[model samples]
Target: MSLSELFISKELTIKDSLAKLDKTAKRILLVMEDEKLQGIITDGDIRRWILNNGDLNERVELAMNRSPISVYEKDVKKAKEILNTNMIEAIPVLNENNNVVDIIFWNENFNRKLNYYKKLENPVVIMAGGKGTRLEPYTKILPKPLIPIGDTPIVERIINKFNEYGCNNYYMTVNYKKNMIKAYFDEKEKPYQVNFVEEKTPLGTAGSLYLLKGIIKETFFVSNCDILIEGNYSGMLKYHKANNNKITLISSLKHYTIPYGVIEIDKNSIVKGMMEKPEYDYLVNTGMYILEPECLHDIPANTFYHMTELIQHYIDKGEKVGVYPVRENSWLDMGQFKEMENMIERLGVSNE
Candidate 1:
């Protein structure tokens, strides 16, 4: 990839810069102004800003390193030493005019898969027992977990991503067409262990989790089968533990725009103001969570309970419940037909 692709303007929003990073599959970005390096931003910088609860709309400069490490010449030996010493991913090679001519990556092979993120060994639970009524016709034929996004099923893709983080142990709660879900995985020779938990009936999100109370004895991740969150899972865990949180939910910034002009009235029935197509932004839950083992007790046995109720339980008790936000594009949902199409497109899966 060209080094120019990682260039961003200082005024660019941290939210957009994150999206850019995901698109490029790279962590570092060069803040360029008139082809001159203004600053540098990395995934670590963004994580710090997020952990600080900084505004997503804030500019990159708010979280960037103004004085980034660079070299006057593209001397491989010197650049390698700097990268190793600093434990950084990439370094910028500057010309005499202080313009970035090339970028030297810690992984010399640009095409090689780079994993700057730590590999997590936490257990992951996939909520795959839902009837998947939203997916209708496809759900009629196969379980949502077994539904193919390309050649592989949605659940497998979720497992694959988690496997990359060294999380091999998995527990899947299953009810509707449980046999199909089991058969599909049974046929494959996967390296990870996927233990299936049978649910007698359709249990609400957190209800089935009660079955895993004794089985799971540590911090674990629970995710919906249809949504894939491509973020730093390892960092999320660290944030959860460091904050001493009981439960931490992964959220995304969702922006909504009203197509019509929005009108606002005061309490006195007076016309306060009008906004032409007002826009609203919110941190929306992405249906992924990291929870301490004890939090499982909040879910009563064999009862219909949603994750929201469990979250509220912690809030009601004044226990620490936190949220980690990712960009909107980073959370891919395929539960519905429209979102399934969007997910497929985003992953570049073949429609055929």
Candidate 2:
């Protein structure tokens, strides 16, 4: 009934995975072609894929968790330690190449504490209608949402992160290559509910949100498809509600240091103070927001409207507006050329 007993090769059959599942560990190692990871097939993946008529004789590769949550080999022990600290039940182990090698089930380490964080009921509205002018030629063929980050599409990664917080309902605004985005999800048949609103003409950020005015009556989340904002999104919602604000702007504090000494002068006279490579922090809008439903009424129909303009409009009306700061690295903007390259390189965007 231990995790070590559930070990099995990717070459094994679903029958093997099922038999291994009985050994008390809900996870099984999937050793695939060489050291490369195929996936970790979970009992849930098997039960669901099978209920949908998955073959039993098929290799575990078919039911394996292709994008299984993993921690790098170097961090394996640390990952185990953190799991123990957080009281996580099961954690996947991965090699240097991010291949699934083992599973860490700390259920036996039992400290008797259940970490259950309640999630807010907010539907995620992704602004995927843009032509991605920043991404240029790549966007010509594929929309920003379809751009690959690591193994999954950028939008899928966003959805998965939100799903972790129990936010399943998603609304994506689409214009360019709308069919391609739809087709990609259609082929995958993911579990969450996804509704696409086609924009006949390009609507600047907040403008497209007007489409959901009636569809979504409660306060909801709005995020750009090209950027991945990582943090406790639920916490942001809590902040918004706590302040009783009409809108909450997710902001990032970016710190930059000057390479050379800088001087402060008075009236263009002698330098008063000087410092070398002093770091300065500035709050930058992260293109993500939580807005009350009534705010959507301000979005002009079929007109271009940026989120900034909406924020300004509300500010002018004396409506409460708040900014929640997130760490700079947490806001990943893959739309910019430099950001896209860095993300692709760091996350290994190529198919494995």
Candidate 3:
């Protein structure tokens, strides 16, 4: 399809622009008025705006790249050069009047070759021992980690995502319905190596890590089996190593809108100001973490302890605990019914 078909009016709402972006599969849209290029809006722009709690119904211009890189149609060669030199995905071609005439996208092969990540040897520990009380009926027959999303189990999907980045060694902490999880892996002949850490009793999230004191000798990843992070794992690892962080939490941007008007009161119990439904944004823990092997020592053995408690312990000790934030949609939670339905729809899977 012609790139012009992806052009959208700056006045269009962010919601409309998103639809156009998804439909075009171009990851960006040219915001134009009267054939003159106003700005450019990309998926990244929208994600950033959403992270900051920007209203979706607001104009696309609010989140667009007002000074986007562009070149004249005569300078198409220069556009390609810019795309290559800057490692950008696309560039817009404009006319003498600063009007968008065309767009040049980076070659798919170039993108694939340039973006490859090296394989990692660090062991990934998945917390799969939860009772999965939220997904009761399904959990009654199958463990939460074994719950299927599409054709594969949710835990398998999580493992596959990490495997893409060369994380092959896996250590899963299993308690509730532990045998089923181990049996499934035993039956399947796969290239990856998996070791199951069976908990004698219910040990909360971080508690099971105590079992890996001498087992994990390097930096590793820990994740909740029921959740999946679609962001770049290598980037998070890089950040953890670069910052010398003891623990790094992968957080997802979440936006919540208040339905009713909010009132602010003063010390005298008098109203200071009243505003209509205000939206708030937060960085919520996505149950994924990169941690140094040394941190495992902090987990007490044979006791129930949550990951949050471990984080708090580090915080109290003034240790380096960082959070890397990703777009809200990148973190999918399939443990809950609402999020499960959303995941099904997003994956284009039939409910049946």
Candidate 4:
């Protein structure tokens, strides 16, 4: 069955069922009764709820849309037709009794042969020109991106993440001793299409994208050079497409545990609740984004423009900006010395 066809019992509340939904995304079957198809809930559905201000404790039935769209057992042809007609990537298969039987992905089944040669036509813009000032003494010589992560450079790892989704054409924004970066890649003969957009002065993060105004036409991927992402870019793109987002930011869940006991205090030294060593999970940006071509106009030329400022500006103007959360371990930030050491000690062997 398609991941969207499986459903839980009607008795479960939305709050109680959230964990199951996330687990199902990991490929578990969501079943409640004997092969009876109930409406399936997905991560997208929960996010939609949050966006709509639906209460977390509310029953899932209230949130779930009844009469879900489905296809018949012998109707594979119809399913493909429906997918193409609706521009849907996946369709659910149902049996004679209306139970979900399987899922058919159009790209996987019908377009597989064609897709082998036709890569996703999207450019990747990387902000690799920064000097690693935060990385201290290391910044004295090597650029942050060139720092060795086992055999490959940190920037190459970031490029490979986009390449996994068939994005090959790359535009690197270079400044802060640009020759070193050029020399390194020149000596190595990098695998993909690599072009440099030279910055006369240090232009901040999003500033470089302004240089790509004419070169990049469609939705493109932009990422920091010092990050390693384990999440799939193809899936992120799918989410971005489904939402009609102008910009999609990749976020990772980060957990922090309090070292000491924490207390909850009410108005006048009154304790509402008390807990010791509470652990909290937060969604943090992974420094990766998918930007629409139109947004490129907002970036000022030769001026400092950080991604955060751009996002805020868009939000104030009432534009749609979405976030896709990856698991905590999926993000590795090598921008700091400690994280770099941790990356080498823990992930270096694997990267090699």
Residue-wise C-alpha lDDT for candidate 1, range 183-239, written one tens digit per residue: 988888999999999999888898999999888999999999999987767767877
Report the number of clashing residue pairs per model: 0, 1, 0, 0
Name the best candidate (by lDDT). Answer: 1
Model 3 lDDT-worst window of ten: 109-118
- Candidate 3 lDDT tens digits, 212-283: 999999999999998988766776787688889999999876778899999999999999999899976677
Instruction: For model 4, give the 10-residue run with minimal summed lDDT.
Output: 23-32
lDDT of 4 by residue, 1-352 (tens): 3454445776677655665644444312233456575565544455567556576567776666455556898877788678666554556688887777687666677753212223666888889888889997877887888887888788887887677667779899988778888888777765688899998877788988888887788988889999887655666777788899989998875667798889899889998887889866566888999899998899998888899989998899999999887655567888887888777775745444
Error of 4 at 92 (Å): 15
Identify the superior model by lDDT, candidate 2 or candidate 3.
3
Question: lDDT per model, in order?
Answer: 0.86, 0.75, 0.84, 0.74
| TM-score winner, 1 or 3 | 1
Model 1 misplaced regions, further than 4 Å? 13-25, 43-58, 69-89, 95-98, 104-118
Where is the poorest 10-residue window by lDDT in model 2?
A: 107-116
Q: Give each prediction's root-mean-square deviation over alpha carbons.
A: 2.8, 16.3, 4.4, 5.3
Stronger candidate by TM-score (2 vs 3) = 3
Q: Each candidate's TM vs. the true structure?
A: 0.88, 0.65, 0.78, 0.70
Q: Write the per-residue lDDT of candidate 2 for residues 203-233, one digit (tens) a residue.
A: 8888888888788999889888977775667
TM-score of predicted model 1? 0.88
Which residue ranges in model 3 land beyond 4 Å of their true spot?
A: 1-117
